[model samples]
Target: MQPSSSPSKFDNMPGDIERRPSVEEALDHEPLEKGWWYKPHVLKLNFLMLAPFVTMAAWGFDISMTNSLQSLEAFNERFDHPSGARLGFYGASTQLGGAFTIFVAPFIIQKLGRRAMCLIGSSIIIGMSIMQTFALNFNMFVAAKLLLGFGSTGVQIAAPVLITELAHPRQRERITAMYNTTIYVGLIAGAWIAFGTQDIPGDRSWQIPTILQVVLPAYQVLTIFLCPESPRWLVAKGQEEKARKILVKYHGGGQETPLVRAEMEAIMAGIEADATRIRFNKTDISALLSHKGNLHRILIATVVAVGSQCTGSGLISAYLPQILDNVGMTSTREKTLINGIINIWTWIIGLGAGYVIPKLSKRSLFLFSTSGMILTFVVWTALSAVYTQQGGYSYGIGVVAMMFIYNAFYGMCWLPLVVAYPLELATTKQRGILFSWMFFCLSMSTFAVNYINPIGLENIGWRYYIITIVFTLLILCLIYFFFVETKGLSLEEVATVFDGRENYDAAVSAVHAVEVKQAGEPEEQHVERKDER
Candidate 1:
């Protein structure tokens, strides 16, 4: 069979012709059991789906290094005891590079497939890690950090989209939650590595951790080729047979089963519906913006992306030691120990939440998380205020406890939802672009928080907690009002929720009509074989 270049076989059909196979007709197939999740092919598919998150962990390793490096004597000796402002710049540079990638990724993702983009991202990360490891000057180090940010953007944008496309519809949430949860594994690894090397007398203390950053990306580059291309991407690229083969292999037990056929039809229908509203061309930004529900999705994506960063996570993660110093923890060893422990706690809680995510609603999770954060910040701010005035060890301890509590809630809710929610909200045709925009929002928020945080800590002290408390409360209200539930829908079905019920029904009908027209001879022959029916 030839690869199709057009969006769909129905392209030559007239604009006024609205015929389609019925939704019922398309859905008429043997009932497939949910136990497909236990099959060997499905298990292998899950592993392949999750492989990219190692890169996410690598990204976390970079972020978590800042906390330990701040207090390490060997690191200070090499970098000349940089000021808080300069260190903040080092952290912000990565985010700045990430923000820059947002504009360029849409084009790259469109031209190259998701797998290729992931490989490119991994290669960039590997090269930057090598550069960062051997940097003789501060500027060289910062330049390497900036490049890591740029490379990470590709990983962040492509990874989730690949998972969404490849995951079983019933299991997407759990799989995505797993992806989000593993990012903390990198953070925990980085923190412990820094803590382990803190007592060393030479540059190797810091250099070793920096060198270790290459491992996960190296693994990604070596193993990513083992995974299949996203079936949705293949179909969108007009390689339906290839897409069908993938679906059968991974999802249909290596045959064109009814379940596989149904899924392909659904994906095709969604693509056709999307193409009708928006040209599939990369230059057609207007088509995306002009769609009825896309703007709302954009708003939700931006708010979720920004809200995840703005909740004071940047301040705490990047400058835990400084925050601890403010709270009377004067020992460097003590501060590093606490930072490592907190990351471990985050990883633990995040892993548990991954299992629980499928059982809870997205809005409920966000509401609970944001609400818990507000309460934690309120108490933490009050405790900090008391500590600032009276200087009690108890108040300082309370502040630290609140930090752990805040991170627990954050890991449980925000971390997993941030990537998964935005992926679900976007149509297949616009998934990459939407993710790019989401990451742009994430990078901007991270940059603002990282750059402003050190200065804020210096100037306002605990009063900065008040800003997060207020913003988090506002985010809670936004979640209650606007965020839609998308717990169990397949990727193609998700489009219907946004496009309105009537339009969805129409789109399904149009898809069915096209399928009937294309299969006219075979369908008629099958019907004749059925005789009495």
Candidate 2:
């Protein structure tokens, strides 16, 4: 179990005859000074990073629109007075499609690359939105829902990986956090659109909002092509020169700077280490399953992914108006207006959280969020129970207020971390597959919650809060015990956290060797080191 100084075994697998240069041999390159963020290339690179968020915003619009659609009289009338149970299935369909998509994503992402996968996914979303707009029956609409889910899963798997790989190490958290926060923008758009259009006569009421879902994805498809493919992905494919060029352009001030060389070496070293441990082929599940440290990663990621959906936020987002109705805000107009306001507030809070994330530790933030959710659910449950028993506006208002508070806390804690943590945890070689698995967990939990929330609301009412309270408490315990701190580490460096402290030290040493080698230092003094193995 001792760490090896040299690359892992998979680095030299049979038929891998292509001779790639070691980090020291690859370049004669200056350390990029601090404040690289102010450079022109970095500024443009930051702007391009927003493409994934645009895709996510479209997905968010669909989700919030579904919640609004359930309350729209025109939609209900046009679709033949569909029951809440059926609406739940409609809500769950996207997740069901997403679950199926994850199994296929690893192959697609490998063969086509991250940019292509996102393009394909965004195209599917555009098509599905059109189909939903013109659907003649509930069945067709359901089919559109399923297809959109499949499409968005592609974007979900690729977007985070793309942004994570493309980002400068110093800004990765802020970039990913901002990506997560964009969902609220879509939610707010969907909410206000639904609110404004709900009074229109005939099918156009729901149709207008459904059709508007195409705008963001259309923008995404147009702009995604302009963004570069992941540099890590490029290296794994043995296009090191291309990867290096991208690093220089975006991260190294258009030169093969020392910072770029160190980063390239760090990435290559991690990939080599991962290759030694796991099969390069996407189909080799056994390799991924048996790889050292991967199981721990999978468990942590699965818990975080599934936990985000099942901890009652899915219930809130998918059925907000219904929950409002349960709490005595029975007017459709009133409910829609309140939902619109809530979406705006959630977006504002989420944007604030994104800005502050780099200052907080992952473990502390997750624990704080889950703790707040538990308390909010307790208060909400109490108010809801009272509202259900004694017909009073005070308890009802309290219930509404608690829901807003719960969303605010959830926005601050869970929303930003879910995407960033998994990307940080998995190494480049396993990132695509890891994201697929994470989304698989997400889709499964989303399916279960979306399907059950309506039924639970009907049968038990306030008692549903009890289920979320228990789940939130359980998540709190899991985060405390299992989640590792990953703040301020490069994605490659984060790999060592699971592998071992010795392995981490080895990675640092490898990067340091490159730094010293570039600085004209004595090889004996700086490069020579023990294998530990």
Q: How many clashes show up per model?
A: 3, 2
TM-score of 2: 0.90
Q: Which of the numbered candidates is closest to the native, going by highest TM-score?
A: 1
lDDT per residue for candidate 1 within 238-267, as digits (tens), equals: 898899899889877687665666677677
Instruction: Look at candidate 2 and tell me the lDDT of residue 240.
Output: 80
The alpha-carbon lDDT assigned to residue 14 of candidate 2 equals 31
Q: Candidate 1 overall Cα lDDT vs. reference?
A: 0.79
lDDT of 2 by residue, 198-269 (tens): 889989999999999888888888898788889998988889889989999998768876567667867866
lDDT of 1 at 117: 81
- For model 2, the stretches where C-alpha displacement exceeds 4 angstroms are 1-37, 276-283, 501-533
**Local distance difference test, each candidate:** 0.79, 0.80
Best candidate according to lDDT: 2
How many clashes in candidate 1? 3
